[model samples]
Target: MTTAWMNATIYTGEDFAEAILTEDGRIKQVGSAEDILSSSPDRVVDLNGRFVLPGFNDSHLHLRHLGKQLQSLSLSGTKSIQELIVRSRQYLKDHPDRSRVALTGSGWNQDQFSEKRFPTKEELDQISSEIPVALTRVCGHVAVVNSRALEVLGLDASTPNPPGGIVEKKHGELTGLLKETALDYLGPLYPELTSEDLRSQFQAAFSAAVELGVTSAQSNDLSGSNTQALAIWNLLLDMDQKGQIPLRLTQQLALDTFEELDAFFEEAKQPPSDHLSMGPIKLYKDGSLGARTALMQKDYADCPGERGTDALSDESIRKVLSWAQENDRGVIIHVIGDGALERVLNLYEETEDPSRHGLVHCQISTKAQLERIKEIGCYVLAQPIFFDYDLKVLVDRVGDELAATSYAFGTLMRKGVSVSLGTDCPVEGVNPLPNLYCAIARTDLEGKPDGGFHPEHAMTLSEAIRAYTAESAFQEGHADNKGKLAPGYLADFVVLQHDPFQEKPDALLRNRVVMTVIGEKIVYTHHGERSTTR
Candidate 1:
């Protein structure tokens, strides 16, 4: 069926238009209302002159984790260890169903804690001595579990740290702190989710995403270590077959080793339909700065001789790269530190097809590295929302000189690199407004560091919007058919409460997605009402 959307101020990606004609979930035409509406169309949607743009496309995020975060205890705002304990205890009291699986909570950062230290295993034990409690830091790179969780995982004093990870030890005893690859050990704690549970999670995440104006996402859910990863992929495939996926999703394969890669390909044969498809290979090159595990060239400003560690072994990364190159697959690695970023850049220089592979969180870097990335012409998925947290501690963690050059959003775009924006959801949030605020405001939510932190690096409102849309679609290798509101593109778009061009940067925080339409369907609308007959 063909649908006509008219009487709207629409952003056809590069410019403005008044109407759009869509058929078979794709844009057939975009032009003046009088021109397109002159022709008969089966359906019509009047946007009421609402400012419209292509639906937001997140270049990198974790949809599965976002759903789980919504379902479990959230320790996000926790400012004190005592408060975290109180919240956990409260969650237990409310649910009282601890037998199904291990207790999981995330979104905590010790940097924000009043005590200025990580919550000890003993402290988590207070939440539940019988139940295994595991909490991940906001960066998703570090995690700490209670003593019981350690016992459940069969980890102890004798247990040694695994490759690219540290099962932190303090005076010959496990601190129940795990970093990088060490997080894989917690797999046993994950209760095998049934097909229904998996579907519910996807549906929940999709609903949340569209409400925030996200029409498409490139997410990392298929991990090498997770045995149930294939089942999750299958669930997505099944959802697409039934047109159940509410958002366009491209799964990033998170296989770190050769064995994992081979095993995954052996079982998972074909990609899904339009709503689902497989994208790049994802791997972690290092950890996060908050945990002092983001590998850097120099020692951290606060702790000398304690430079962060690497998450991917050189041998493993090289082998995987070789395999990917041979199989013609794209690879995107998580590298937050300059040292790690430099190594990945060097490795990518040798890539047979650098366009297909790039880096995620290419944050801390030098001017030379930025220039190098531009020359390579590869994708760089950055999170300006990270500045909400990173700005508060960047100078102290990475030192003044390096911190000054970090998160060069505008610079990358000007230098002509394939740059895109995302929140890395469940870490910051999937909300694009806060991310846009941080990008243009160059400050945190509270508006700290007046005049904005490193304001020079801040992206213009137009630049940020395009990064979240066109550039993101480009990142997932679907630039031609997604992102834009141009002819031949997917009929996915959002109607906003404010015309961003006429508003101040802070006004974005107040901006709301008045409506969201995907695949010629009005999936979400303000005031809890959806309409397609308008």
Candidate 2:
């Protein structure tokens, strides 16, 4: 059915337009309210002067992780080990089922600990000596387990470190900390999540994304050594095909094993439906700043003579890049530290194609690298939410001088790089507007370190919106069909209660999404109470 939305302030992402008419899920006209309404659509929505913009496209997100996190114990806001323990204890008491319990949560900062250490087995043992509990850090790159968990996994000091991971141990005993691919450290002891559990988490994740106004997402960690996650994703895809999957998704195929990656490249040549597309083959160049695993060219100022290690070998990275280029797949490399950034640039240079793929977290790149990215025209999908959380860690690790250079969004955009923004959800939380707030504020929530962190790198509100919307679509090679609110573009748009560009930078966070429409359907609306058309 044809629909017309009038009395709206429309942002086409290229120009300011007024009113819009849609038919068969494509914009049919863009003109004055009176002129468009003359066509007479099946339904007319008087936007009542609300601001309308293109629906947001999340370039990088873990949909399954988001859903699972909701059902798991949330330790995201805990400030100390004691607080984490208290939170976990309270959850267990509420559930009261130790035999079938698997505690999962995120957001624990090891560097912020009183001892500047990771949670030891002793601390977790004190909290629940009976349950197998694993709490991941905010980054989801590192996790700490309790003695009960370790014992359940049969992991001990004698367990050899798996490839691409590390087991933090002290006194020749497993300290319950797993880093990188070594998460298998507690696997044998951990209970496998039932298919029923995964299905529930998948639905929860999909529901959460739709409620948040996300119609499409490029899901990371789809195919990797993480067998369980991959299987769950397959189930999600099956449900999607059956039309049970409520959200559209693009799944990233991580190149963990050569054979598996080769198989993926073969399968990705024929793209799937809009509901499911093969995303880039993801690779991790370094760890996160929160865990001090992001490889840096120079030693962390806080820890002299210590530089983080690269998650993968240079040769392995080159091989993956070469293969992706030879085939038609794309690459999304995660590089947070300057050292990692340098390596990715060098690899891209060798590949000799600026558009072969994109960089996930190009947080710290040099002037030369920035210029090179512009020259090559690669997408730099950055997460500004890290500006606050990782900034604190950066300040602590590399000192104020280096922290000021982290998450350089404005710099990349000004240099003509294809800059896009995302929440990196669950890692940074699922909210998109707060990310917009960070892009403009360019500082932490409390407004720290006067003049903002890297004031020169701050993005204007308009720029932030484009990064979250238009540029995000460009990242996934959907620029023509998505991003803009122009004629012929998909009828995916959101009506805002306030104009983000017109509102004060700080006040943008206070603004809410009034209504969200995807594919000519109202997926979410919040007039007086929450409602959905899905």
Best candidate (score: lDDT): 1
| Regions more than 4 Å wrong, model 1 | 528-534
Q: After superposition, how far is residue 150 of candidate 2 from its true place, in Å?
A: 2.3
What is the per-residue lDDT of model 2 for residues 472-530, given as tens digits with 9 covering 90 to 100? 88888788888888888888888888887787777767777778788777777775743
lDDT against the true structure, each candidate = 0.86, 0.76
- Using all chains and alpha carbons, the TM-scores for the candidates as numbered come to 0.96, 0.93
| Model 1: per-residue Cα lDDT at residue 68 | 82
Model 2 clash pairs?
152-189, 153-189
How far does residue 443 in candidate 1 sit from its true spot (Å)? 1.2
**What's the TM for model 1?**
0.96
Query: Model 1: how far is 75 from its true place, Å?
Result: 1.1
Model 1: per-residue Cα lDDT at residue 286:
88
Output the lDDT of residue 234, model 2. Answer: 66
